[model samples]
Target: MKAARIYLSVLCLSLGFLFGFSPAEKKSKATWIWQSEIIGQDKQQVLEFCEQNEINLIYLRIDMNKPSDYYRSFIREATAQGIEVHAVAGHPAWAFTSNQKRMMNIVGWVKKYNLESEPNERIRGIQLDIEPYLLPQWETERDRVIREWQANVEAFTEAVRDETGLMSSVALAFWLDDIPTPDNPDMPLSKWMIDQFDTICIMAYRDRLNGSNGILSLIEQEMQEADELGRRVLVAVNLKKDMNDHASFAEEGVVEMNRQLALLPEHLEQHPSYGGIAIHDYRNWKEAAADMPPVDRDHYKGTYIWRAETIRTEKDEILAFAKENDVNLLYVRIDMQQPLSMYQDFVREAKAAGIEVHAMGGHPIWALTESRGKILKLVNWVKAYNQEVSSGEQFHGVHLDIEPYVMPVWREKKEAVLRQWMGNIEAFVEATKHETNLEVSVDLAAWLDKTPTPGQPDKPFAHWMMEQMDHTTLMAFRDQAEGIIGLVENQMKYAQSIDKKLVVAVETKESHEGDFITFYEEGRGEMNRQLQLVTKALEGYSSFMGQAIHAYEYWKNGKE
Candidate 1:
């Protein structure tokens, strides 16, 4: 057992929480389908559509012939933003193949893909759509056809459990509940699906829910059975236009469809298995829903994750607080020995909450002398961990907190140490990009703008760092709002031109350096007031990503 050694407690369900909040869970809010047609097209549009709609899951049609890297890249990027991708594929015949060979092949393929993938480049789960209803004599010979279909599902599920190590989901029609199995005559076919698979997606398909056979009534039994089984049901609506208009939202337009979809939670969320709703395909959804709202801010408004408390905390509580406070990013250190399962859970929760977890740890010495080897090891660790965990559970990026100026080498030769620091950061970024596709960020002292480079005496060191790195945090560790603003004001002014994202961070951790160095004594309430002031002051710069608290321990301690 690998023990995760850390000064702080670290557990997250997604985005890999930095500080030590212990637990978090997500109720699937939104989901969508991708029918593989958008594979080569403008994929960015689909991602944007999901982001805007707050879609938490995607059922992507698995084109088996497609290269592993192709799926890896898309799934990796999708998961980083909190959208999970499950490989969905099935022809009615696939379920009937000799020995369930087709299902075995898919499992083998995903296994190989996982073996080869960089961390974050793996699929979340397996969702299959083996629609036996499409067979030639479905209307004439329904009973036998349903039983055969049920047998196929059993075989496929067995293979998934024995070989793939992935959660299983089966696409189902709302009326599947009408058919019951021989062994369990009382159990509905829909209930059997829920009982057998990790998740069941009821293709409700209808745009309305008022009367009998409408969306709600169709899935009522599935939801009830799922709740009893301690499983989940994903309600799927249609965007496919050629299908029945009552089933597809296409004819209703975006606004009316959204109104109906919103009522799902109103009626069904009371059930334990009410995971969320999923639309048929992204392309159709995007084309038809032109009036959906746009995402507001896409920058860093984060906090320092710390774990300096005697009492434990709930991650759900912390996440709730984060949402209310507009904290979307978290910076924390990584303990290499951490259990892979723990990080996987953290990343999932964080992504669902739309919070970024940047792995935050670096000593000045790690950058100062002969540190390239150390840097490589660190990058490798992130790569290993990211690869080891489930898709969204991987770290969002690296937040290197290497303050070289605080070292003795900086005192002896300030510019040389700064140059070494910049070189180390550059190398880390290069290696991280090569090893893992996660975003790279570093912490900088605010005064770097005033401190000129060693050889180029006229050019500020901050400019060089800015050119080398795009996402950065300025350690404007002042207690007062004015002091914080004054320190990072120049960076705020110049960051736009350099095309960099700068997070202005203040200290809340208790510091022996100076009383004015931190707001730990002032408390979280006071820190919030000062941070609000800083936000107001820097409202002028669109490049001002936002502010960050030093660490969770001090922040939480202040609350106490």
Candidate 2:
């Protein structure tokens, strides 16, 4: 009976191959290792995590700076465990015509690395995670951005065409199915991508397995497209805690996540295109599985320093005043032309004294669409500065004080200005998203709570702004606690609903606007007293992050 069974199996396999049918394919269970540096730091821990989780494939982010030996060791060990490691690299900017070279650089590097490495240690494939939809231009210039993105994709495909056995893949958003292809409007962008790449990892980041908006439903179209094209598709889920409840399994815990994931093979095995599941990243998965404690949010007592030179000239006085006033956060203005050493010293001292310093810059014109380069310049400067500085000397966040309302164009083109402002904010967030340690914040006027968003009238513009940022400082500018609380009541409710942070701000500059707008005449004693009342009033609101004073110069010169 055993001999007959073996004979039958061999015969069936041979006949299937001859008849253009393939035997049962092994589905790949994959995950992404975004922090490539982790392999150098803790390779064993990463391997053990993958081994324990039964992961057979890893899309390891390539850090070109790291020596090839690190990747060789990791890939060799991974291959020994029946796992295949693919090189992963990308950035949103790479979708632009000017940045296509950056995308190709990854291809060039991976090709070189594979050539130098042993067969078992070689990278099995390459995956691009570039999502051009995150760009601000995607909203205002959708057609142009799409064309450029298509060109980039074509360039990428052509670049890798000759690299044999290097399976090409891309991590794409599921909604691309709704977008028509640039050249052929009849076909969906998702289908175009499916045809271009060997495998498509659809980021179907829903938490549940079933429902109209669940993981299975979201990837249905992509799966069908991939099936028709005879390509593989991996359903990717986010494990990051910051995503919305439906977008991640962060709150559901590993056991529940696994329970839902185990159902995938049963439902998807019928489709030959279903390649298996890919988690968003390694660090978040490990941390979530370990049930790590949440970081504490200390109340922010922040003040803005408009002059970059103040940090160098008044370092002693600033430190003394901050110590006396219990100030924990400072938004210091950045002078791009100044040497980074000046700020580094101040930041290091401030950090040692338990005060976090954020790089601050903005102008009224920055909100204009034409001024996007300026924003990118600042973002790039901060990123570069951070790279050059030590941890203790690095800026903790970025604060934008771009008051578009101050521009004359705001009065003439209110809607246009609002649209442009929104785009700039999107650009800022996209540029900063990868900086995991840097927080993004903006100064919002209190009256914005009453203004309706340009297209989203059901929600206030303030709510939309708060939703984009990690935290916002409401320029309530009221002298009394009740008045300040009243100005930000709607924002507080919205912030609490979204689980975002809000910081109430008071003015110290002697305002030509109104007496109630500033604490300049009220003296430091009265200002402190009023702030205490405001803190007490807002204590019950979970979104209340504490208070901020307007300007450092004015606050220091205010009445004693």
Candidate 3:
């Protein structure tokens, strides 16, 4: 029988946590969709700009025929920042045939975003995008009859949504002749088209519409017609050039931009079904940040705690690790003594490794012992740690890794010092708790297991270090193998009794000792076997859900 590895992704319901269906292709809230459309800067930096501005919605343009890694970082960054993204693809209406290959691609996207699962699945819905402006030059070549196109749209939507539960929407030219428009005689077919979608975005700009009709007026009219059919409306107002060969909002027509924006709320009031707006391009909206509100400082302020530098190395390494280990939960460290600027190499490494790292903050021995004159610098270190964790993707959670040390004779005095030390630590944890939903975990001293105490309902750490983390590990190694196993098992049971998560940590340093150590050194079997066994052993004791290896370097070296 195959043994399942302990992992959070497996147990947690695969809900729509990332992408969703929307008529508009918006990159972020800071994006005004009025001017500019090119995202050439660092992906993380642009994403940070969004977080700081409290922008959660984003639209990414990807080729339906070709796939690339450019969107990988965008998706990762969006997931980390809790931003929801929708994908828009450009293809001729002819490409969406009722064939099996196209059917498979649609299903693949649904699974990739995990939209077919329970709860807030990654994708809220899919878009049946028909950019009429990009239509074939000859009207005869393009299928103008909305009925023919509607059949394929509904087929593709059903195939993808039946498995993923993603809602569906469509984008179409706002010509009075479009399918949902009541006056259109060619396809007065509202039932067939409207039934397949949760919403429809009237592309109320471009061509004669942009020149003759104001955007707000078009939105009001389409929304009224959509509501009459009991369908939701998503307004696609233009932020760029129009059908009249006029310049985009940025290049030539800057003055009338804000005037157009002021009409959005009024249009919504006029036609309440307006779901939201989708900007033309991501790069354009990001460039317009200069005219928006001040960047939000608190949004990106926090600390990251990592488990290894290897998870920070390269994409192949990260992906290989995930595939080999059947897990993607990566740990990264954020040292409070080191400035966040110094961790770029680590962050880049992790990003390359495809590892989503969080941070852990604490001072080095040197900084903690420095004179009082360095107090302000010390405070800045704390603040910067906060900012980086709150902003950085490679850094996932706030981890405090201060080795709990006390000589056997000075144990009492050390405990008092720990209490005093934790005073600042407590403030840091509490401060972080209020800011982000990122999970918080800590590495505590082994001595917390010397005597176990009961944890309160909400306060698990009341008895030990587990209180400080959403889940925490007791680095148990260097002792006898059986003893090490026993300690971890006990913690798991106790934590489970209190309804808290317990992480079983295995040190690679210990795996290097004894018989298994010699086998590990000789490469007799898979290093993953050790990982699998420990995970199985813990599962034998309590509700074991996940396992965290000690260090990336040690694991890479095949050490126990």
Candidate 4:
């Protein structure tokens, strides 16, 4: 009788705990994307607003346009308020060569406000903006002008380093895929400028015509390409404008925020080569978010799955998991290596499964190499149905699969031959948007983190792709290792802080070690664990846009 009474008590207690206990709901963490448009009185108010609202990262433009005291006071105030100051040279006058007074003035303020020590490192870094005007593509005398500016900028940076020991960085012209444009082989100025700067910021936010808002994949392609030309690299995130503002953003207008947040972790996992993100301006974010609809995670879940490959089998597996677990989003992958005919069937099945698809054409390089115009023709075929296949029903984007161009022959002919290579893609993307209204995306090699082979000149590829593309899908699967994780963290943190839409391309491969450390075998369980960790780590920061698993087949096999 006593034993029965004890058992009943224990059962009641267990039931009580089970019924009463609930996991804490996730609080919305604010990303580092901030507004810089608040000027004069408005600026001060916004800074205070950020502080009150717990905004830790702040972006500002301290140029000739603003008074000297304005910048000094702004930095000082931001520091006191526990906000990190991320500033950019606003106008041409702030350019190192053109505006000596302004350059020195800004450097002095940075030195005063830039943090070196203890509890709060409020001032993160200074950004030297160098976006070229489209109207004046190249100036005959502009080369000389650039040369002068480069020298002064280097000197100014050296002065800052001497004082603070913190290396100064610059945001260079986002365009310029390769040095010595095919037209002017003698132009060493670009290369010279690249060498002078501590880190190169590739602005990967052009290519608006190729289906707006798919900027992360474009950034990845550029990062890989830039790896060819320069070693030290970072990327810029455009917090404003979703593919020219025609294609709408997620309800929260938090597309950039989500993209960067997701990107930083994934990039850290795959590519430690990235420095971080250089946000365009704080104001753009402020304005965009205000007009944004309240975040609907349900709709977010729907938009999240744009490419669901082999949905008939995979969709059911994913749906079962999502339903059982009450998960809203499911990561999907598709490859060009797979037959084009399978796409329609996959789409139909995915829809039935109640899964949203984020389809990326897995292998553009392989497909193009195999038939030259196969992808373009596939787009044509998809466009054949204007009804069932309204623009939205087609895959969310195409994933361009390009391996690092390691061959010397390929390197030498980069600009001349690759002009057509890029042209074909640009044309294909433009035509696709015109027809399907779907965006195009691409995957890039995580090659930038390593040094280029001694003989290769264009090793850092981000320098190349930044010139043309806006979206990038980066492979960031190996970043969790201790040696690599720090690099990954810093790079992703920086990317998120800057506000670019970046997707960390995670690999479904795993690791196993017995006899080999450097070349150990990979496993499936490890890949799944890595994905969960990467996603969890990148929760709050902006600049992340979901993730791209290495391949659909790899993921499916790993589960099996």
Task: Identify the candidate with maximal lDDT.
Answer: 2
Q: For residues 1-560, write the lDDT of model 1, one tens digit per residue.
A: 12242311122122233322333345454455555757456578778877766677887877778888778778887888887777777777654445367666776777678778875888767787888778775677767666676777887677677654678898888887887765687877788778889988889988787789589888888888899999888888887785567878788776566656655654874797877677777777777776554324445678876441211235556666677777788875666555544455455565656677777677778767587667656665666566544444568787677777777777888767776776787788786786346788888888889988778888888777777675778999888998998898888778888777788888877789997899977878888889889988987787788777776556655753
For candidate 3, the 10 contiguous residues with the lowest summed lDDT are: 13-22
lDDT of each: 0.72, 0.83, 0.47, 0.47
Q: Residue by residue across 1-560, what tens digits does model 3's lDDT show?
A: 01133332222111112111112222223232111122324666667766654456554543434333444445565667777655543355433343435534654665564533333325445565654345554255444444445556766677756755556666656554443422455553434455567777666653222334656544454566676776776555455545554324544332244334423543354444655555444455445545554533211111122434433344346445544644435555433334333344444334333344555444322112232223223333333333333132224555555553533423645444444444545555554554345566666544466633332234333345565567665665422345456656767777677666665555554353474322235331444465456655776544454555555445556633
Residue pairs in collision within model 2: none
Task: Residues 288-401, candidate 2: write the lDDT tens digits.
Answer: 878843323547898999999988889889988988887889999888666665776688667656677999989999989999878766765666566554454578888899
What TM-score does structure 3 among the candidates reach?
0.42
lDDT value for candidate 4? Answer: 0.47
Query: In model 3, which regions exceed 4 Å deviation?
Result: 1-319, 335-356, 362-394, 406-412, 451-462, 478-481, 510-527, 540-543
- Indicate the TM-score of model 4: 0.39
Deviation of model 1 at 524, angstroms: 3.1
Candidate 4 lDDT score at position 24: 21
Superposed Cα deviation of residue 469, candidate 2 (Å) = 60
- Using TM-score as the measure, name the better of candidate 2 and candidate 3: 2
- Candidate 2 wrongly placed segments (more than 4 Å): 1-22, 292-560
Scored by Cα lDDT, where does model 1 land?
0.72
- Candidate 1 residue runs with Cα over 4 Å from true position: 1-170, 173-179, 182-298, 306-314
